[model samples]
Target chain A: MTDASNYSLLLDEIAAELDIPPSKYAQAVQRYTSVGEWLCGDDNSDCMDDPDVYPQGSFRLGTIVRPLKDGKESDYDIDLVFEIKKEKYATTSKEIKERVGTRLNNHGTYRRLLKPEGRRCWTLEYSETDDVGFHLDILPAIPKTPRTGAIHITHRSGNGTYEWSTSNPKGYAQWFEAKNITAFITLEKTQKNMLFESNRELFSSVDDVPNQLIKTPLQRTIQILKRHRDQRFANHPSHSSKPISMIITTLAAQLYSNETTTFEALKNIVFKLDAHANLQQHDFILEKSLADQKLILRTPDDKWIIPNPVAPEENFADRWHENNHERAKMFFQWVKWVREDLVDILAKRSVAQLTESIEPFFGERAVKMASSRLPFLTAPGIITLIPTNTPHIEITNPPKPWSK
Target chain B: MKEIVERHFQELVSEFKYLSLVHEEPEIFSIQGNIEFTSSYSEEIIHDSYNITIFIPSDYPNSPPCAQETGGRIHPSFHTHNEGTLCLASNIETVRIFDENRTLMHFVKALLIPYLHQHSYYEKYGKMPFGELSHGAKGIVEYYGEYFNTSNPIITLLLLKIIAEDNYRGHSICPCGSGKKIRICHGEKLLALKKLKPNSFFVYEYAECVFDGLESDSIPTELKSNYIYKKISNKNVWQHRSTTHSPTK
Candidate 1:
């Protein structure tokens, strides 16, 4: 049997290679920082006073992987939340969205790259020389309270009014970060030192470290899963309601127990995720009078909830109830698929065989890149017998048809 | 062999947090533990349960241990017999299911737990959780029928009888209702069974159990005489064995 620890190391190496490089991540931070400055600049102060801008989604969680579209590596969606405060909570949702869009449009460089208004976010697409690029999805919002982490973001409803939608992206990120805090920080330091040693000009000190560059076991597990999901659903664009990154991150975090290796964490998380996806037969009810008692992955109040760890009121699966549980089904299917694939890949003894098996799920390009960077990627080491006075190479058995 | 059993015992302890090994010896293993059998609507803890005498036979795994409950409180009707021996599983069935990897832990979890669960369920619901398999010889026949994918008990008995005699006629019609020659249908299965229980004595022992009610002191010489066989009995042979020998209700 293959040591589970070894397979875990292999997965970590692969995830590290697939992750966005520190240089590219640093560039993203710089761009977002500039946008944050503009959002709070002297000219835009009237729209919202002292607005804050920060990343959300995989970017904030440090689980960003090279996105795939139709089997081709593509742009990463860097989610940024622009939050503001005002004395009166009277500003219409439309005004808040427009104010942020107008600020981006007013900027000379952003005007060319700014996309037409999305339902919630105003996107800015950045061009790149390689296949990989970036799409900055800047969302405008207001906090639920001055100190609380919850926020209400604006979304254009079908009734033609921008309504406030509850979200807690910061809270979710904090919960994810706390899952493997020590490992993440330790890796962050190691990554920074390595970056400094390699290129002293790029990073002068540890504080200059690219925080997003370090990958923890939990983060790597999520990255591998996200990549698998992207490649698996690449062809089914119309059926593109695959499990979202936040739900996956939340569920994986809930199942993670700070396993020392990425492989172990991924294996455990995949299995646990699949286990939860199974609808508990006992939880189902058949009586008509029990109509008010349906709790299929929901609270007793009948709200479909995979509760935000930091805020109980925020249900990440709120949309699932309305979508005929399509997202739930897709999420469970992906969980089972990932579990089976990981089990099959981890059972392979030969490195070449293991790489071959994982390529279908992680993509050939990513697997190849990971294999090249792996320390033991070379062929199995030769076993040399100790030299004797009269050494002889002896054949144990004649090669037969079956043996060949 | 000792190492294998010890390792499996350790695994059983770890896998089931509630279970613990109270005593261990060269030929006997006594496990005393409790488990929370939680179902949909309710959760109940079955406490102070122990199967004291698990007689590990010399030909273990091939022959499973006959576990007997230690406490006298459990009624004989609850999956156990008058001698307090628990019918955890059919030896033939468990061996076939687990094959070469039939370790003590696998047997305990797969078969022993179900037996215990049945008792606990009976205590709660006043009935067996599922239909109980008939005990002793009749149960063995029923089990083999399922294993052979046959529904008729008479066919099972006759097939074993033929295997016991080692007189499988290729020209004889298959007993599986397949309307095929015996050489093709069920031939492989019969050969496999023969390989497992090579001595004809074991097969005859099963045959004797199946036909024990037929005659008081007959060697059961002939099976070709269908007329004689039909005239011998026209009642529930199992019921006539003894009033004490009742089928699992």
Candidate 2:
């Protein structure tokens, strides 16, 4: 759990420097929504909408990103929840442990600290002071469930505001087919003190996200801005990579804190470092549907997710749509030398030079040519889809259904 | 059934005519009688040291035993990251002794029995094996004067991990077994010892791991007449598992 007061102090300091009201914390909520919505409806096929994600026990399905109490000013962990749902769940813990142990025994390392306990819970860790090795854990949590076998999820507004919802996933799926408001739910009673259910959604964990929606991407344009922003900041001085701590600090200080994140800014960042980042990922999937095409966008159960554009009908395998005249050979080398110092700076700044300042470097060949070659981007098949029903209209391949 | 393994183990130890080594390293003497089998491990663990802890599940033979490790003290590989528990291939619990046609006598004599004196750090106050620098632990054979014999650390971190993981799926093997794998013999006591000093790698006395069944003739007092066979038994599954020889506190 994080000490909110401690973070409020840090946020207060930043606010003083920016001359923004402390209540501006409200804006973060909007940014989060934008990130989520953008991911759900991006051009990349990796963004997925999964009705199939369900918790077996006391586990919840989203990521918990918050400040840490370690006081190092930058230490934190991304905690996730998962538990077994069957009568044999207890036995599952031991089995899960053995599965991991078997792999370690085969891999072999130099030294270590930590061993499995008898009854429940197992962790694998390493420390230079006490021990030196990487650690992983399989913790057991006893979930609180209703005897009647129904599930409930709750939401909180800023300060005293609050909202709650009850759901029977089995029934929700049947109904989701008839409605399209975007179903949300939670399988865990609590996620960092903010209770999550199987239906209600909250991106920043802060309440009242719908009203404060500017920081969020109201449309698709923000996605492109964010990609470009990410690429421009990929390389900056002061970036370190030996121990993981430095990279983590850089991430929190330079990336997650940014409220001005845009889709294009992000695309430029991703395009340079890893052009194939979400190449194999899909947007969504249509399961057991009457539609002739079952292809639905696929989403992953990971921390970061986003939407990508389908290739324009005019452009196929040719990524050289706009820059056919420019030599692509030298461009690839420049991207290979990326670092995260720029990301650190971007994490705090509201605008990026990639879209405004750096766009001119590529000239006319950069902006307009990309669409001339490729029609639609194809997501990989790494995700699983169990869709009930989602809206879909056939793409006639004209300006590539994306424009229409 | 590690028991079939136990039988072949029994025959292997019987072949060393208790008195034969008398002609070799005279400091060690024996009047060959029944040799005990102790300690066995899965081949999956590919770490620094060969030492392992195999857990014997309740349903023996039919159900495969689980292999685990501890201390992360040593490893032939970096399998166990920290908590020093490595798990090996599982669900294979049939009596499997290396060579089928070999008699227990030939097995023990030909394969084990030599491990008893493999490197007895017991002679020293647990300091013979190592220093704090070379390897994290103490009390092991100084292989090459710098590292423990099996790289100076008798138990590698990887082997420890494999054994620790084994406990999850199988039973722990007490190092004090007569000569059997901890799984088939006195495994409960070993499990109890888990919490004592799990992460304290250097504190565990390697000498204690040596199963000293018969009294050392050098100690005198209780050999039928004075010519008691002082044989340091080779490592056989039964001998490693035997609870008959109590561990000296």
Candidate 3:
């Protein structure tokens, strides 16, 4: 019975039927933003003067496919890169990659990611049918200060997590960027033509053209966001802690060599996400319904995917940042409640409370997905509050043992 | 709690305790709840013609409270409008600004009685409920309005929104150089394509959304904002005490 335009009737009815708490939605948004910020490297972007490059969207928005015939599944491959520009992170391409590998480890069941393997990096891909698949890719650039001929995105590895042969791939990407050129050349030992370029000119396949060269960071971000919303997510679970909003803001904040940022910049990005129109027009009203859970929309049989909804508060990431601890606590309190309820629901269906069990709810066709998760369970940069034996503050029944 | 609900709760707890490699549960922040509605009314109350359940987490200060409907009730809005998910904006907007330092007990109490009873149609045509608190407006309808569509296959539509949002919210940075908001910059176009091609699938979904968003020409150079470049950087916030210690320079 909302007085709003009723622009999305479907969303209204669903919310009426499900009736999730307001706090749950806020917490979900907060969690999504937290994951996104870490992935992108900045948790705030609402105050950005210009938000297009750093503008907002949802985790699912990261996965819209290209307009082409074959580019349906993976039009863009983007990962949440945290402190990626830090010298400590980029110190050695190998070290940066190894760190990413450790951060990305998820019980080791899906495709493996070798931070910056020889030519490409591999990570886990969740599949409803296949259960799991190998997602191998490489970043656009790597640490090349001292190393040459490093590695590419997709590198098969018998080596360690994200470990590449001593060869450096950063040299090539950097070389291409500096020269603003592209080339299709066999990777010395491999005969495969690895298209290298700063611009789109170097694409070899008719499909690889990137549609355009030097896509605005916003443009590039759009593709990344679209990917998360596409039908493929229904097909599998990437299970990343990285949320699309955070990643977009981070890229926007760091689009240039010297871009400095604040929380407002990130919030601007969230607003952009709210304006999207992939879902049924009626669903527009329920934009926040999608906030609570890490979602993937699947038809009854789990094949087709409806369009994704965007977050309305994308332009408001900074307002929350003024009080990070407070915001986190608020977000987590609701999530824990929801998690308890969801655990009950999943238990009835015989699903576990751990991540693996959370799938049925996300994958369900009646997919009104919200979760009550342990907030600090697997965040990339969040510091787990562990108390030492100093006894500085008396501890009465300490909380349950912390998550690993 | 009834046996079934308790069983369900136990099942969920079990999953949290056992998530494997593929499926992972969200991290739990804290657990606490209030009997505000139940204590005040001593029973479930229907406001705006919907039954609601209120629940809180253990980490009351660190986490926000949650309330959801337990009984099944079909909502009216599902028949119209294409934005299928619930439009729970104000409610989310309210609690989204929660401060752990502030006692949320009052805020939590507001959600059930006066909040739900007050001007109800916040999402409807031209009705604006004045205040930062959306105790009932958010959870009452917005949550499902987007995902549950009576006109189309529910799952297909949900998938589209999830994928699209995932793409937008999942990334660490925008691929585009402009600083404008992504939704205004490229959101409509991506969703438009998704609506246009329901059966169509993608290899990397967001990548496709962007390619199509850009190919369709929604991205304009003028869309870039002067504030964008500055916003994404990890710079100091105005009046933040952390500025003294952050020393980005």
Per-residue C-alpha lDDT of model 2 across residues B105-157, encoded as one tens digit per residue = 33232222222112122222333121121222221222111221134222332
Off by over 4 Å in 3: A1-228, A231-269, A272-404, B1-112, B128-249
lDDT of 1 by residue, B1-249 (tens): 566666767776554433354445666555543332322212343332332345565666566665665433355666565567775555555454445366766555455555665565566678654445565566666666765778776677667666766667877888777899888988878777766665444444454345542223333333333332333234455346324432111
What is the per-residue lDDT of model 1 for residues A1-404, given as tens digits with 9 covering 90 to 100?
A: 12355467678877876687777887788888998888788463575777888899888888888787668778888999999774337687888888888888888999999998889999999987765679999989988855657788899976777887877888777777788787776677776777677656667777777676677788899888888888778776525678887778877777777786787788777766555654523385434422332222655654466766777666778876555667667777778888767753443223444577778888887788877775464444321121122111121111110000
Each candidate: chain B TM-score: 0.66, 0.19, 0.27
Residue range B6-46, candidate 3, lDDT tens digits: 34344432312221111122423222111112121222232
Where is model 1 more than 4 Å wrong at Cα? A1-3, A88-90, A158-160, A185-191, A198-201, A280-304, A321-324, A378-404, B1-249
Model 2 chain A is weakest, by summed lDDT over 10 consecutive residues, at A395-404
Q: Return the interface RMSD of the candidates, in order shown, one decimal each.
A: 23.7, 33.2, 18.0
Task: Give lDDT tens digits, candidate 3, residues A239-297.
Answer: 22223334333333222221111112222343333322232222333356343332323
Find the candidate with the highest lDDT and give its number: 1
For every candidate in turn, the CA RMSD to the true structure comes to 16.1, 31.2, 31.5
Stronger candidate by lDDT (1 vs 2)? 1
A369 in model 3: Cα distance from truth in Å? Answer: 14
DockQ of candidate 3 relative to the true structure: 0.01
**Better model by DockQ: candidate 1 vs candidate 2:** 1
lDDT of 1 at A65: 82
DockQ ranking, best first = 1, 3, 2
Model 3 chain A poorest ten-residue lDDT run? A395-404
Q: Whole-model Cα lDDT per candidate?
A: 0.64, 0.25, 0.29
